[model samples]
Target: MDFEELYQDIVLDHSRRPRNFGELAEAQFHAHGDNPNCGDEVTVHLKLGANDAIDALTFTGNGCSICMASASLMTLKMKHKSRAESGELIHAFHDMLTAEQESEPDKRLGDLRVFQSVRRFPQRVKCATLPWHALEEALGKPAGGEVSFSEDTAG
Candidate 1:
């Protein structure tokens, strides 16, 4: 199949039946993020393991296919990753989605790579990146135990 077909398949499959969807009963950290412009929102939950690895991760949300699918893919990609590693991957993902010129998404993203198309639609960038930012905020609020950020997409 071609790239469009592959992208569509992955996006549809993930959005329809996202992996790691719903909530984590033992989540050590949690955060809610929203994109008011498009009304996309997600709540991310995760558990930190012995060495700061994300032993469990999940999310609950209502968003566009891109947002929901990206969140689903993120849980799969982020599981077993150290906090620092997760941070790095988050940065890389945002970069990949927002890059100014067309280029291949990092192979490490696997199926998530199909999101490179998001670059062409700046508004959707917030939808795609919302979960990652929520994850970061969730992880960052170690003391608070929970965090939230409604993206100010207005420029």
Candidate 2:
């Protein structure tokens, strides 16, 4: 199959059977994000281990295929990564989708790069990113332990 087809299949697979698609009983951080325009909502749960590495990551929510697939891919990519590394990757992923010049996807993004085509659809962009925004919020408020992101106020 062609690369485009392969990418689509991968996304479909993840969306249909998302990995890490639940809550963490031992979560150290948690955050929720929603896109009011599309009604996509996601919550990220994190548990940090030694050296600030992600011991576990999971999510729970309902949204479009793009949103679900992105959340699944994000859990797989961020697992075992240090908080610092995950932070950089989060920025890189956002840049990949929002860059004005349509640049190459960062190698660090792994299969998460499959969503590059999402940039073409502005609305889909928010769908794919809602999970990441929640992850960012989770990572940022370590002390608070919980946070929320509403696209209405994100501007």
Best by TM-score: 2
Clashing pairs in 1: none
Per-residue accuracy of model 2 over 1-155 as CA lDDT, tens digit each: 34363359889999999999998999999999988887789999999897888999999999988999999999999999998899899999999999888998899998888888887676578888889999989988857488887886453
For every model shown, the clashing-pair count is 0, 0
Worst window of 10 by summed lDDT in candidate 1: 1-10
All models: lDDT? Answer: 0.85, 0.88
User: What TM-score does candidate 1 get on C-alpha atoms?
Assistant: 0.91
Residue 75 local lDDT, model 1: 94
Query: For every model shown, what is its TM-score relative to the native structure?
Result: 0.91, 0.92
User: Residue 91 in candidate 1 has what lDDT?
Assistant: 78
